[model samples]
Target: MPSSQTRPTPAPLLKPGETVVLFDGVCKLCNGWARFLIRHDHQRRVRLAAVQSPEGQALLAWAGLPVDQFDTMAVIRDRQYWERSDAFFEVIGQLSARWQPLRLLRIVPRRLRDWAYDRIALNRYRLFGKYDTCLLPNPDHEQRFLKITMPFVAKSEN
Candidate 1:
């Protein structure tokens, strides 16, 4: 396989030290997870992106993932892609110390963890629910998402 650094196209850009989470915007379970991340990531270390969005598509392409057949959520940072259960841990790793305990889940063998994750991901829409259209992010958290077109708000240059 060709190295990521040698890919013809440039890697998707992200803010320094920021990890971008790409998920299915229409899946209720996924939307809920996004809300949970928004609520707990106090330092705003994570950014959200819907797999259907331009930014997410670019990242997926860069990661050599199938943008059209997206089945699992992913976390990307510093040109690295973390998928399935690993993606979950990647985001958890960026959270506060309170989340440190969750790391113990790693003790459960990655293959098993990934198998469990696959079951949910494959049936996410059926098990949870899905929207006909992608739900837009709430105004309060719009800034944390990529490809969102929130209403214009002037900022003081001070």
Candidate 2:
């Protein structure tokens, strides 16, 4: 059996109105997506957390999701949890115009969309080079991430 230590720690209690996005920290593609969101989200409405983080684990448990199945992106919006393609679309909907157009993907059936997402997720490590560790956020974006056991932010030049 996988040790409980391998499982993520429970997340901290979040205030209402916080939308947390949990992702695979070591996945290069996932890290890129987080940076993309941070860049496009001019309003700074979204908060990011890694699936391996305590806060992320807590949120996954609260949402009744299996922590081991976090290979793909997960979005917690309005207190509701979304995974795979559904999570992707919902996140785009919250972004600015260029990203909002992605919301049209909702027209695709959930099963079909998630099937495609799963395929990419399965091959992500092979297709997109993974990191030895998660990407640390730059200082300017530090406020965007919730601190976890590992340092998730890089030092600022300032």
Candidate 3:
């Protein structure tokens, strides 16, 4: 994870009332989390974006985060952005009432929580593998995804 001193000064990625989640497009674990959110977020108040997409890159640029290294999930609410463990808690806290209990994990210190998060993140691809291409949302959930002109594509086989 990027240090606070190196992290970007956030720029607005969504409208004042919108909340967007930026995740690694090909990370299997991240995709699972996205699916989890879809199932549990009864209010459907959040939108999703792949960190490698154009919009994601632009937002990262504006937020002063490195576009090349996506080590943490981000939750962008209104004009604010939270990454690492804070991002997880922020999103879970707003989820369905039954899911809100996940927020209790915040009782853990930020450093310890982020350390665990980073460990899993570092091994995510090795442990869970990666998708050949970015995952597209189902038609019913299309509106919940931020469209990017340039989507990630898997390299062609020779």
Candidate 4:
């Protein structure tokens, strides 16, 4: 339950066995993906972070990713980093039936698969639009979200 506000930003470096997903929090499609994972991730196997958040930036830097490129999803798994299609596939592999079918696309050549992924990512905002701000987690699932003060967590009456 570490809050981004209180923790000093660590110099960017990858951590072993930790799976951190960095995403564009304000993107409607991205938020929907996170929510879907939250509901289906029965074991709570992944950690979430908004690409715009401090912790997200730290992670990106540590993983040696470009700060300006937050358009694609990034997954840091087993101390190794994956971006674009690889990251998306890795995520789906960990989720339930809701996303499991995406794993089948892995059989396609990496370049082609990534090309499709990039097209969708590039047009995500145009197709799905975006939130004025990051989506807040549902109270019951708040514990699954990475806490960042700037976006302001929505209070859950529960």
In TM-score terms, which candidate is top? Answer: 1
- What lDDT tens digits, residue by residue, belong to model 4 across residues 45-141? 7878888887788777777777767778887655466788888777776776777776787788878878998899999999999899877777887
Whichever of 3 and 4 has more TM-score, that candidate is 3
Q: What TM-score against the true fold does each predicted structure earn?
A: 0.85, 0.80, 0.84, 0.77
Which candidate order results from sorting by lDDT in descending order? 1, 3, 2, 4
lDDT of each: 0.84, 0.76, 0.80, 0.74
Off by over 4 Å in 2: 1-12, 148-158
Model with the higher TM-score, candidate 1 or 2: 1
lDDT for each residue of candidate 3 in 1-158, tens digit (9 for 90 to 100): 22222233434557666778889999999999988888877788888888998888977776777899989898776556788888888787768788767777777888999999999998999999999998888898777787654678999999
| Model 4: lowest-lDDT 10 consecutive positions | 1-10
> Per-residue lDDT tens digits of candidate 1, residues 1-158?
11112345435668655689999988999999999999999999999999988888988888888989979998877757788988888888889999978878878888899999999999998999999988889898999997634588999998
lDDT of 2 by residue, 20-75 (tens): 78989888899998998899899987889988877788777877778877677777
Q: Quote model 3's TM-score.
A: 0.84
Please estimate how well model 3 matches the true structure, expressed as its whole-model Cα lDDT: 0.80
Best by lDDT: 1
User: What value does the lDDT take at residue 42 in candidate 3?
Assistant: 75
